[model samples]
Target: MTAPRSGSILTTYRRHKELLLLLLPSMVLLVLFNYVPMVGLVLAFKDYMASLGMVRSPWVGLENFQRLFASEDFPRALRNTATISLLRLTFGFVAPIVLALMLNEVRVSWFKRGVQTLTYLPYFLSWVILGGMFLMLLGSEGPVNWLVQAAGHSPVSFLSNGAWFIVTIILTGIWQSAGYGAVIYLAALAGIDPNLYEAAAIDGAGRWKQTRHVTLPCLAPTIVVLLILSLSNILNAGFDQIYNMFNPMVYDVGDIIDTYVLRRMVYQDFGLATAAGLFKSVIGLLLVVSANGAARRLSGGEHGIW
Candidate 1:
């Protein structure tokens, strides 16, 4: 039996040699970029000295983590991460789903394609560029402020003001990502059987009824899967966007875990920064597991990471 299985495996490998060869580069890249860097995670528990190198670094156990949690900036960063993540999850998550549904209903192919192109164009632009564009647009003497002054009101600093800054981040995130994110839902929608809609129509269902009973039910599994996956990003509040858009003035409401770690690294606290990163990773893993479990239970084993 073992000899037969080995021969079978060899046969399969030989048959798919070309495909395996094609995948070799990606496999190598995955190991080099993703798996290899995991070794540096140990720096979180060590008093890392660049001169001593990773292997010779003194092991300090949880001291780095303790210092990270005890830092004055920790609470503010945590609060900002949680608030912004939640806001994005609430609004940003739904925007794509709605856009996908709307696009799916469009009868004109050219118009729908044009709409998709325009909406998703922002997603392809780097936040570094978009950040500067947004800043200029929202600047005190920029077009928006100029229009505000024309209307006889004070020029509000959208990027500098804490509350407005948070709202801006969420709205801009939705605008940037909604169209691209909707692509997944659109794929899911395409996989849905047209016969289901026909059946519903034959049963006296109108457009709204068909949508409620057919379209949504078919999309539920995909929605749940994406929602469970999103839980893992609870601590990640888009470093590029926040880092570029925010100044010290809005740190109270805009500083997130990534930005905090970047700040620590800038100050040469490598150990503390590593500890904070590890902390975020650990929390994110726990959240993914918990959310997966909840999704499995709520969905009667129909949805989960597993």
Candidate 2:
């Protein structure tokens, strides 16, 4: 009995040997790039002078966190980050699903492919280039403002204004990411059985009704998974986009946790900067856990991110 059991185990391991070999590099990279750096989180709670170094430095429990929360700019930055993130969650989350539905309805494969290519191109462009494009279109004398002022109303400042920059960030966030997000729904659409749609149509269901009753219900699980994953990053708030487009005039409405850390890093306050980084990471961890727990409790679905 023991010999047969050992033989079965060896046979199973041999069957998967090739697949395991292929995955070995990625597992190694994950450990080296991701899990290994977690030790540096200690810097968040320590006063690291060059003389004392990381390990030898005296531990200062929560002093950095205390200073961080006490700062006036931190609250304003938190609000700006939250508002932009919520707006992105609303529009950006749904925009791709809508795009996918429209794409799926396209009878012509070529047209669908063309639409996919056009939308996906923007996702690859760097934020620096996108920033330049927005600047040209929304600048003080740019064509968009040019047209606006060409009409009766006075010219509005796009960059320097706080409120408008918030809108600009949200719109740009959608533009850069929506198409890529659509690719997931497109794959989900491909999984759906065409027989379901045919049956609905035979039952006299119209296009909108087919979408509402058939497509949406089939897509509900995918939507739930994506929503749970998105909730994990509710605190991110697109640091690169905001950093490139914003200036001192709009920091109150545009600054986020990442930008705050970057500013302190510039001043060479490594301790405070590390604390802020750790804070962002910890909040991200809590949000994901809470979101995943709620999802599991409500749906009894399996989406353990860990």
In the order shown, the candidates' Cα RMSDs to the true structure are 3.7, 4.1
Q: Rate the local accuracy (lDDT) of all candidates.
A: 0.91, 0.87
Compute each candidate's TM-score over C-alphas: 0.85, 0.86
lDDT of 1: 0.91
lDDT of 1 by residue, 221-265 (tens): 888778877967789889999998999999999989999999999
Native-referenced Cα lDDT, model 2 = 0.87
Choose the strongest candidate by lDDT. 1
Q: In candidate 2, what are the lDDT values of residues 1-306, reduced to their tens digit? A: 344454576787798899889999999999999987788789889987879888998999999889888988777777878888888999889999999999999999999999999888889999899988998888878888878888966778888898888888888888888889899899989999999999999999999999999999988988987788788888899988888899999887888988988998898787888998998899998998988887776567665464
Off by over 4 Å in 1: 1-36, 289-306
